[model samples]
Target: MKIEIPYGDSSETVELADRNVEGVLYPNPVRSGDEQQVLRKAIENPINSPKLEEFLNGKKRILLIVNDATRPTPTARIMEIIYPLLKGKDFKILIATGAHRAPTEEEYDFIFGRLYQEIRDRIVVHDAKKSECISIGKTRHGTEMRLNKLVIESDAIIPIGSVEPHYFAGYTGGRKSFLPGVASYDTITANHRLAISQDAQALRLKGNPVAEEMEDAEALFLKLNIFSIMTVLDSNHKTYAAAAGNLRDSFQALIKKADEVFCVPIKRQAEIVVTVATEPTDIDLYQSQKALDNGKYALKDGGIIILVSACRSGIGSQTFLDLLGSEKSCKAVIEKLNREYKLGYHKAGKMAEIGLRSQMWAVTPLDPETIRKAHMRPFRSVSEALAEAFKEKGPDAKVIFIMDGGLTIPRLT
Candidate 1:
C-alpha cells in the first residue's frame, strides 16, 4: 500500500509492505474494570491502610497533587474515590501544575470534567509559580527543589499523575509531581536545562546523564520523606496500576508498568519528519517550539521536516509573542540575543542550531510573516507541503512520517 507522508512543509507518498500489520500492538489499553480495580486494590492493600486512614482521620493535613492537562486524566474518578475516603478528614487536594501556568475555567473544565465543581469547591489549587512555595531544601546536587508551603506543612504529601514517556526525563509522574508540578521555578528550570543539554545527539532513555541526575533529584525528594501515591495510566489515561506504599517502592512498581505502556516499539532512526500540533501544551510559539526536538530525532542530520499546526487558537503567550515581534528568523533572533539581551544566549544559540541544521517547513493558517519570522517556509496546506517536500527531497529519498509529532513517540515493533 502507498501512503502519502508529510515531510517538512511537503508530502510524499511512499509504498509500504503489502502485509496487513497495522495497530497490532497497543501501548496501553484500558479495560472496563482496570481503573476501578486498580483503585480498589490500592485501597484494599493493608500497607496503604494505616497512612490512608491517617489522612482520612484528619490528624495531619493532606495534599493531593495531580496532573492537570495530559490525557487519560483520572481526575474525577480518582477524586471520587479519594474524597469519599478522606471526607470529614483534615486533608486538602491541590492541582500540581508546573510552570505551564494555571488553567482558566475552560481549561479547568477540560481538566477536571464533571468533577471540576466538586474538586474546586473542596480543594485548593496551587499554582507552582505564583503560590507561596517555600525552600523545602536542596538536593545533594545543589539543586534547590522547593515545594508549596502548604505541601511542606502537610503531615503527608501524596502525588498523583499519569505516567508517560517524556522526551527528556524518560518518563513523567512519580516524583515529577512534587518537583516540576509543585517545586520552585529554579528547580524546574535547572532540571529542564540539564535534560536539554545532555546527549543532544540521542535524546532517549539510555546512557543519558540528565535522566540520571533527574533520578537523583527524585531520590532526594523522597529522602526528605515526601510520601507519594503514584498511578500508571494506559494510553487511554485510565488507571492500569496503582501503588500506595513507600514513595520509592510504590512509584517503582508503577514506573515499571508505565515503561511497558510508554516505552514501546523503539526506533533506530528516521530521515524525514512530520509533526501535528496539540494545544495548551502547544499553546504558544515557545511552548510549541519544544516539539521541534522530536523532529531533530526524525531527521538524518540534514533531512527535511514538516510541521502542521492549525494553531487557529492563536499564539498563546505574551512573552513568546514579544520575542517574535522583533526577530526576523530564528538564527537572526539568536544573534540579536547574543548581541543584546546576552541572557539565555546559549539557549538561543542551541535553539538556532537545532532549527538551522534541518531543512524545515510549516503548514499552518498562521500569518506568512509570522511563519517566516519563525525561520520556517510556510506552505498553503498539508498536501502542498507534502508535494513541495517530495520535490525537494526527490522521489526516491527515504522518508518518515509522524502524526502528532509533539505527543507521539514512535517505537519499532
Candidate 2:
C-alpha cells in the first residue's frame, strides 16, 4: 500500500507492504460543502448568544483577536463576513502572536489573503513583551492575568480561531485566544506552567486545570461583552463547522463538532509509528512538536517514532531551541523544568520526556545538528528512516501511519 503523507506545500508517498502496516488513521468522514457559506451562517446564527448585529448594539471600538500564522484559522473568510457588519463602528484586528515572533509582511499577506489590502492598516501584531499589556488581576489558579491593553480599553472583544485537540489546555479556541494568544509574556508563562499535570492532556476538558484556569482568566473580561467565533476545519483544512456566541458556550458547541471530526480509535499500540505534521503545523519545529506528542499515545515503550515535518522555517522560537540545547540529558531537562517552568521551554521538556521513553527520528528540511540538539535523529527521507527502524526492530515489526498527526488523536480500544 502507498500512503501519501503531508510534507510542506505538497505530499510524499511511501510504499509499504500490506502485512507490515497495522493501521492508517484519519478523522471521521464529514459532509463537504461551501466553506464560506458555513462560516456566514455560523456568524448570523450564534450558538447560545445573540446575533452579531444584536450583540454589537451601541458598542464601539471592537477588538478582534485572531490566531497567528502557526494556527490554521481561516481569518480572511471570517473577516469578510465580519468587517462589513461593523461598518460604522470602530474595530481593529489584533494578531494573537503569543510569545512567538511577529509575522512578516509576506506572511501577513498570506494569512489575510485578499482581505489584506482592505484591512491591512487596521491590523495590529500583539507584542507579548511590550508594556502595552495591562494587568486585570489574577486567575484562581494564581496566573497573573495581564492582557493586551486594547482588550481592556475596547468596548467589545471577539476572539476568532479554529478548534482542535491541543496537547495542553484540552483544546484550542475560546479562552485560549486570550490567555496565551494576546496575553503578556508573564501571563503566558504563568498559565502554561499547569501543563506538567496529566489532566492537561489532549481531548480532556472536565478536570483539565489548564483549560479551567484559562476560562477563569477569560471570565475576568466577561463584563466587556466578549463574544467569540470558533471554527473547526476538515482534513483538507476547509471549514467544517463553526460556532459563535458567549466564549465558553460557543466553544463547547464547536468542541462537539471537533471531536467528531478529529478523534480516531485504534485496536492497539504499535511498535513503530510514522506520522506527518501536515501543512500549517509543519511550518516549524515549535509547532510540529504536537505531532510527536500525539503520536506517542499510539506508540509502545521503547518503540520508534518516525515523524515527517518540513520545518521549512526552522525552529519557530529561539526560547524553545535554547531550552532544548541547554540540557545535556533528558533527566536534567526534566529536573530543570520541575524547578522552573517556562512557556516555550515546556515544549522542549515534552520532547525530552518522549525521547526518554522512546526513540524518535525526524525527516525535515532542518539541519541535522539542529535536529540532534532536540534529541531527535534527523533523516533526509522517510523511506530511509523507516528502513533503518525496520532493520532494528526486525522485518515483521508492527507499524501504523497517521495521515494528520497534529490533529488526529488515536485512542486504544
Candidate 3:
C-alpha cells in the first residue's frame, strides 16, 4: 500500500505491505452544501441573537477578532462574505495572535487573502506582551481575564474563527477568540496553566477547566454586544458548516459540525502509528505536537509513533524545547513541569506524558539533535522512521496512518 502523508504544503509517499497496514484514518467525508450561501444565510438569520445588520445597529465602534497564522481558519473567505457589510463602518481588524508572533507579510496575505491590500491600513497585529490590557475580574479558577484594550474600546465585537477539535480545550473558537486569542501573555499563561490537568483534554468540555474558564471569560465581553461567526471545514478545508449569532450559541451549533468532520473512530490501536501534521499546523514543532497528542489515541502503549511534519520555521516555542531538553527523560520533564509551570510548559508536559507510555520519533526538516532534545528520535524520511520502528515492533507490526493528525481526533470502538 502506498500512502501520502501531508508534510507542510506538500506530501511524502510511503509504501508498506497491504496486510501490515491497519487502516488509514482521515477526517470524515462530510456531505457537501453551498458554503458561501450558507455563510451569508447564517449571517442574515442568526441563532439566539440578532442578525448582522441588527447587531450592527446603534454600535459605533466594532472590533473583529480573527485567528492568527497558526490555525487553518477560512478568515479570507469569511472576509469575502462580510467585507461588503462592514464597508464604510467604524471597525478595525485585530489578529488574535495570543502569544504567537505577528504575522509575516506572507502570513498576512494568507490571513486576509485579496482583502489584505484593501484593509491593510486598518489592521492591528496584537502584541500580547507589549499591548496594554485591562483586567476583567477573575474566573472561579483564578485565571485573570486581561483582554486587549481594543476589545474594550469597541462597542461591538465580532469574533470570526473556525471550530476544530483542540488538543487541550475540547474545541477551538467562540470564547477562545477572547481568552487566549487577544488576551495578555500573563493572562494566557494563567489560563493555559490549567492545561496540565488531565481533565483539560480533547473532545471533552464538561469538566475541562480550560474550556470552562474559557467560557467563563466570555461574560467579560457581553457588554460589547458580541456577534460571532464560527465555521467548520471539511477534510479538504472547504467550509462544511457555518454558524453565526450569540457567541456561545453559535459555537454550540458548530461543535457538532466540528465533531462530524474531525472525530474519527477506529477498530483498534496499532503497533506503529504514523501521524502527519497538516499545513499551517506543521509550521513549527510546537504546533505540530498536537499531531503527536492526537496520534497516541490510535497507538498502543509501548508502540512507536512516528510524527511527520515539515517544521519549516523550526521549533515554535523555545520554552517548550528548553523544558524537554533540560530533563533527561520525559518522567523528569513532567516532574519539572509540576514544580514550575510556564506558558509553553504544557506542550512539553503533554508530550512528556505521552513519552512515558510510548516511543516518540519524528520525520521533519529540523536537525537530528533538536529532535533528540525533545526526546524523539529523528529521521530524514517517514519511510526510514517506519522502517526503524517496524524493526523494533517486528516485521509484522500493524501500522496506522493518521492523515490529518493535527485535526483528526481518533477514538477506539
**Predicted structure with the largest lDDT when compared to the true one:** 3
Question: Which ranges in model 1 have alpha carbons more than 4 Å from their true place?
Answer: 1-33, 46-51, 70-72, 200-213, 223-227, 264-269, 279-281, 289-291, 316-353, 411-413
Best by TM-score: 3
lDDT per residue as tens, model 2, 257-331: 898888888998888999889877887999999999899998999999988999878888777777777888777
Task: Residues 1-413, candidate 3: write the lDDT tens digits.
Answer: 88887777777898999989998999999885887887888888889997888788878898899999898888998889888888988999999999998889999999999999999988998888999888878888887788899898888889999999999999998999988999999999999999999898999999999998887887766766799999999998888999999999899999988998998989999999999988888989999999999999999999999999998789999999999999999999999999998889999999998999999999999989999999999999888898898889898999989988999998887
Per-residue accuracy of model 1 over 1-413 as CA lDDT, tens digit each: 67654333444554544431132123444453567778767755624335665544544676777776533456667666666666666667777766665667777777666877765765666665578877756665577767778777776666766665566566666676776777766667665555434463222455655466556666666544344566776655567777775665675666567656544353444455665555433554444554555555556677667776656345544444444446756667655654543222323444466666776687667788777755677886766775676677666555555544554555554
Clashing pairs in 3: none
The weakest ten consecutive residues by lDDT in model 2 span 218-227
Cα misplacement distance, residue 24 of candidate 2 (Å):
1.9
Deviation from native of the Cα of residue 5 in model 1, angstroms: 9.9
Residue-level error in angstroms, candidate 2, position 59 = 2.1
lDDT of 3 at 265: 89
TM agreement with the true structure for every prediction: 0.78, 0.96, 0.98
If candidate 2 were superposed on the true structure by all CA atoms, what would the RMSD be? 1.5
Cα RMSD for candidates in order: 5.0, 1.5, 1.0
What is the descending TM-score order?
3, 2, 1
